[model samples]
Target: MRPLEGHHAIVTGGGSGIGAAIARTLAAQGARLTLVGRRAAPIEALAHALHGTAVTADVTDRAQVDAALAHARAANGPVTILINNAGAAESTPFARIDAAGWRRMMAINLDAVFHCTQAALPDLRAASAGRIVTVASTAALKGYAYTAAYAAAKHGVLGLTRSLALELAGTSVTVNAVCPGFTDTAIVAEAAANIARISGRTPDAARAELARFNPQGRLITPEEVAASVLWLCLPDSGSITGQAIAIAGGEVM
Candidate 1:
């Protein structure tokens, strides 16, 4: 039988990129999935393809999160696995960072995790084995130029994950963070395009510049990130909480 055959999962930001990959991976393991995202069309299409549910909610809004959870519960039962994958990143020089940008970063990256986890906590606790996986980033583990706001927000996510892991110790729940670097996603493609515009480099050269951050000199695949998340959700991984597993090809180590 599949490891997650009987579990129900809620994956935030499940419309595309890493979230979409994780949702597909979990579904393959037989977890009943609810793909939650701000945009309904993408997640709805994916959910139909995967035989899962799709919920539209702005994770930063508490009421929206609660409503989404309610809908998910009705469709797939209580959530035994919660993937806090909804987040955004921005690159602005410290001197140029404004209050609006800082707040936006924190709202999506850190605040959303808090809201979603709280909403899902009861369901997670009721399960024999529960998992909460947050998709953070390499910025959470270290510093980066022109990304002070983004880095700070991601760092807060890691801090929250560690604290909750310990707070829920002795329970059936496990909380952890997966941090990937220079991933080959739409976000990275936009960054590469921006680099090309700013530096007059070819698109391929711009992408290579971002990939150079990893010692392997390649972008991390969404499938690779999904694999890590799947491993954490396995029942055998109950003891593996409070970890910031870096999927950055030794870049953070």
Candidate 2:
């Protein structure tokens, strides 16, 4: 039998990148999926391809989150697995960081996690087993230059994951964070382009600069992060709560 057969999962930011990859993986394992994102088109296309439901809602907004969950429940039943994969990152020096930028980072990276988790908690508790995985970043574990706001928000995500893991101890629910480093996604591509503009280097060179952080000397793939998330959601992984699993190719260690 498939590991996730008959489970219902909600994946935030499921339109593309890591969230889309995770959604695909979970669906292949037989889970019914709800793809949630701020934009409907991308997720709707993905959901159509995957035979899942697409929900349009901004995770940062509590009302939208609640409405999305209600829609998801109506479409796919109660969520048994929650992947808090909706996030954004901005690169700005500490000195230049504005209040709006800082709050935006926190809203998408940290607040979205809070709102989604709370909205799904009841369904998770009622499930035979529940798994909550947040796609945090290596920034959550260590500092990154010109990303103070992003780093701080990711750090908050890790803290929230740890706290909830402990708070839900002894229950069937497991909460954890997957921290990836310099993933090769559109976000990184944009960052590389920004670096190219600032440093007058080719985009490839700018990408290489970021990849140097990983011992493997390559950016992590979205599928690799999805694999880690899949593992955490397995029935055998009930004891793995509260941990921050790094998929950074040894960057953190």
Q: How many residue pairs clash (N, CA or C atoms closer than 3 angstroms) in each of the candidate models, in the order given?
A: 0, 0
**Worst lDDT 10-window in candidate 2:** 244-253
In candidate 1, the residue pairs with backbone N, CA or C atoms under 3 Å apart (3 or more residues apart, or in different chains) clash, namely: none
Segments in model 2 whose C-alpha atoms lie over 4 Å from true places = none
Number of clashing residue pairs, candidate 2: 0
User: How much is the lDDT of residue 144 in candidate 1?
Assistant: 91
**lDDT, model 2, position 146:** 92
TM-score of each: 0.99, 0.99
Candidate 1 — which residues are off by over 4 angstroms?
A: none
Q: Against the unseen true structure, what C-alpha lDDT does each candidate score?
A: 0.95, 0.95
| lDDT score, candidate 1, position 223 | 94
